[model samples]
Target: MRLQPRFRRPGGPWQASDAVLAIPLGLIVAILIADILTPPNLPLGPLLIVAPTMTAWFAGPLLTGAVGAIAVAAQVGAGVALGILDMAFLAQVLALVAVAVLVTGLCYLRTRHIQELAQVRTVSEVAQRAVLRPLPHRIGPLQVASAYLAAEENALIGGDLYAAVRTPSGTRLIIGDVMGKGLTAIGDAALLLGAFREAAHRRAELPELMAHLEQSVCVNLAQPAEGGEAGEGFITAAVLDVPDKSPKVQMVTCGHPPPLILHARQVAALPAARPAPPLGLCEMFSPEYFVDTFALQAGDLLLLYTDGVIEARNSHGAFYPLTERVARWPQISPPELVDRLCVDLLEHVGGRLTDDAAVIAIQRTQDAA
Candidate 1:
């Protein structure tokens, strides 16, 4: 059965909890009634602390305090009804209030910590947007869809990167992964993306654009660090140029995974015509790069992804069979295809991916001759 896309509404840091607050409050009332009706020796006053503590987990400090106050009032009334206005009953009431105050404060601190995390996630998302702008659903003669899964589950951006933009020559795109994860790789990705975006517009040839990216990385990597080697990192990338007027796609692979072309219910990996080294290490050996041109028919879908997807491992240590899995969704749209792949990938790996994964699906529309 085909899985439908699930839409989730955007929520803020201060979004209300889905739990019913009235249930806890009613339980507090029930506990007070039981204390008043039960035998004097039953001693149900201690149970009143549970009300405020429960509220603390799901509510703000003010609401927790309010619940605590109600609990304290019930305890005092119980003491009065039992005719036990002695110092012992007074001590019990004091202890209940103290517990309430402590629980309320703790809940407040927990809420604040969650809010801080939400704020951090928000900031990361904004930064990711600035670095990796949203890809268009339709670009020239293609229907496009892309997905990125960060290695850090909570992060909005990761080492895996992709971009697609229309140029005078054609619709140019790149998908790549840096050597490492976190901020440093993100920095490299941002550098590569910036270079690609700018150079794709100015350069007419695909190889020249690739050279521009390599030159940018070489310059950045050559900069001396505080205690590390100048050329300590490299990025594995694949660049594709789909001409606006031709039913052909040109590709250049740089120590990156070969792209998969899906057509006629089969997935074929498009190997580069000539091997090329990663972007940053071009200064070391000066490796030669070449573009491989493939026929892209109207119904053909071109998929570019990072190693994270292929290298994803299950409990049995088996890498994900992307080609085999992709065969199951031959008739789906580009967006649906991407969504299905993401869901299946996560399911194959037991719901958590250790590395960052990124994939872009571009289907040549029927408008193409």
Candidate 2:
């Protein structure tokens, strides 16, 4: 169903209420002056329609109706002042009233539709918070920042997800993408985030944490497909562990995108040496996930993201070059870096994305304790 476009109230050096009062007053003054300046044969009564038609855009139904009524009253007074209250002049008055009534009805319907849309958007934002609470700006010694963009417009949550929290061993984080769309994908994302949050504190090693996540997925999703084969539901994930005292970060990839490391005006992809299967299908085809250790010195930045960022296409069907664009800024704060990336990504895809995207940035500060 195609919905009506939302009517935006007046702003930017103009107030809605002020315009409502000022427009009809200006119209009445102009009508009076035109009646006096022109000859009696010239009909200036029809110009009264301008007041209500313009006011309908910025006022509520009742206010619009009042403006329409004022316009009709002004036309009748003009006729009396000109000493011609005959059938032709009376007919003009009736026509002005009819047009005002129609415009008022249209304004009423437009206002009602806008209210309903606002309520729906509020509910969606609340659901997004229930699924994925906002990540903090700081986790332990690292400055953290995150951003998410859903595939559907007016939607707040989707298949892409990320979580970062201070754990017993260190600060552990995971960014994953579930294998579907809409509510089904959101459910899977919520389940994965819940499992990761619980297991991250107990398991210190990256492989062990991924193992726990795999077990959770296997137990939670076992329904058979239409052909009686096991259901194919899986999540591509990347898990990372950052210890407090060491300048090293350990990462494990499960068929997901490798993270990028930025240091000293250089950017490089940290691809997994031996990649394993995604979470849900690992039970059927067991593959050993390996922990790839890389040095993460102070002032270095680590960026974890979903495939949506790299898969966004332009008008020419060209995928976004994330690595090339991100290398330009190696010394900004984590929050500023994420903000810049979000703006640039939107520009690359012409201000819209076909898939859900997410990004998490963590910077190892220079004064780590």
Candidate 3:
């Protein structure tokens, strides 16, 4: 399903309270202006000092200072012209104007900083879209949900990857682990996914589809050295083919973890009936390497994940316990289960991780209209 930026209230160390200051600032400005027109018995020029502060409280310091400077200059010029205000008062008004301008200048600087932050966020959001496209809601009637996290503190993309699509033959799905991290791994991941989509539709059988992927990578690996190509890079992927209304799903393991099966709210590991060696290797498969089959049921869910989820090591170096963690979450809809699993995994790692992660969950939905 499609994802959105998780919304949370803006949080930070500094927050100026405008509520308590708004009314008082407004009333003070009102009183100062009244004194200007209706001269009071007592000189109220000193009270005009707070006029600029009202702008800071409501519109932020930058606009506040501008208003303050204008009010102070007008009051000073008028008072001196009328001969009612003394030299001391004129000096006081100039000082107040200078202070207001200084405060507003600081506000202007902060506003520029905030704009820079917004620009950075926009760039991040675009990169995320280019990296992880929005997931489809239903792939051949299997309700799907996914969660992806980049390794770095503020990263929005990563090396771990997954994709699912429905074809005439069956529903094609893949989950893979790129060897390393950073932009290089992400590029390889993109190539892998691009090949998988086109090849999954072209190949006649599971092994053939796997071969198509290997060949795509091999072609790149064999490119001229000047092309910035690496000869031995490879990814471990698990490819699945599930037909419409079928009770069993055919799959091949290319050095990927076994998919978890969820039925009636219980989770179990689906045995790889006959696992195949990972793609991109010559003579890597033995006679035993063949397509595995999983007997599925209505409402059954299959989960494919990258090593990031399982290999997440804590400060103590103990790997994350994924199987055990899911065992505790009572069965729910595919989306809900996906959500809870993500939460549980994040909690396991203390809300942060050093490696990228990806999770793909598919549950058979009631027949579509």
Candidate 4:
């Protein structure tokens, strides 16, 4: 998926915030005038440092240095005007120059740090798109839309993941959340998604596909990670197979939240009759994975999401009402539905989520052949 573009000012180097530079420039002029008007003993040249220091806050090193030079020139002009080019006045000029240089150096460091941060964000976005490949907007008779949010500040992806593959007989979809948060969880999420995309096309049966995923997870967790113990993590996931000509969806819930079916004004949560254990912990329970079949009529929407959606809490500590909220917009398009739910979910949590969230809306657009 393409990452959203960040908002930028239309102009070149100078941004809208650069307009504030006028304040510091005006300060320089005021200080110069004050120094010239004041008595020779009460020089205001030292006050000129304020201009460059203030400029450093909004402008980069080059602009800050230029302002500092102007401040220094104004101090010299003040000295010449008052005919006080003595040791005392020279000391004030040197002090002003020192302060200006200090602030300019700090500005350079700040600008470099921001550039580095932008690079990291760009890399993370690339990784996110590669791992969670975008679901086709139209796959066979299904219309699909998905959204993902990371809990980590400035991160594009985290533990939550989702992907869809178009197979010869059907469309296979998976939405999952790894055990942890932040960058630590990305490795496991990528592993699961990679396994799904590769195995979805090869495995004809939903149970077989789910079994392969569980085995993949088990093998992955059994190996010790860098400085961490082995077999320490697990993932909650829901996998679905929607055949091109079938009027039903085959699903296997592995310790994940149930998918909700929205038809007209009704919202029904499809909980698996015999849900399997989460991928990595399947060995602890019966090895068999059961596939539950649910009717998916034309125009019916399937809502799949990670736990982050329902677990989102407001200021009052109440969880978000996903089913109730979805029932209100049952007839909306898949894209519109996903967009609305994402917006509402963020608002319910006061604009910051405590966990990584992923949501997918799939609508069956035609009847079975």
TM-score of candidate 1 relative to the true fold: 0.89
Candidate 3's residue-wise lDDT over 161-237, tens digit each?
78876688568888888777777677778888888877877787888888778777667656654467555666788
Local distance difference test, each candidate? 0.84, 0.85, 0.71, 0.87
The TM-score values for the models, in the order shown, are 0.89, 0.85, 0.72, 0.94
Which candidate ranks first by lDDT, i.e. highest?
4
Candidate 2 lDDT over 1-369, as tens digits, reads 126454545232445555456867698779868976799899888898888888887777777798899888888888888788999998898899889999999998887778887888788889888888889988878889999988786787799989986876568888999998888788888988999988888885777888889988887677564577665689999988898878878888999999999988899999999988888995578768798899888889998999999999999999999999988887888899899998999888888899999999998885445
User: What is the Cα-based lDDT of residue 132 in candidate 4?
Assistant: 78
- Tens digits of per-residue lDDT, candidate 4, 28-130, equal 9998998888888788889999988887776778888999999999899878877888998889889999999999999888877777778887987887888
Q: lDDT of candidate 1? A: 0.84
Better of 2 and 3 by lDDT: 2
Q: List the residue pairs that clash in candidate 4.
A: none
State the weakest 10-residue window (summed lDDT) of model 2. Answer: 6-15
Q: Give candidate 4's TM-score.
A: 0.94
Ranking by TM-score: 4, 1, 2, 3
Candidate 3 ranges with C-alpha deviation above 4 Å: 1-64, 67-103, 219-233, 264-266, 271-289, 314-316, 366-369
List the candidate 2 regions with Cα displacement exceeding 4 Å.
1-17, 32-42, 86-91, 223-232, 282-284, 366-369
lDDT of 3 at 156: 67
What is the C-alpha lDDT profile of model 1 across 1-369, one tens digit per residue?
224332112232444453556767888889988988898878888898988888776667877888899999888988887898888788889999999999988877777777777678688899988898879999988899999887685676788888987887679999999988888888889989999988888887778888788889989988886577785789999988898778878888999998888889889988887869988885577766788889999889988889999999999999999999988888678999899999999999898899999999999887455
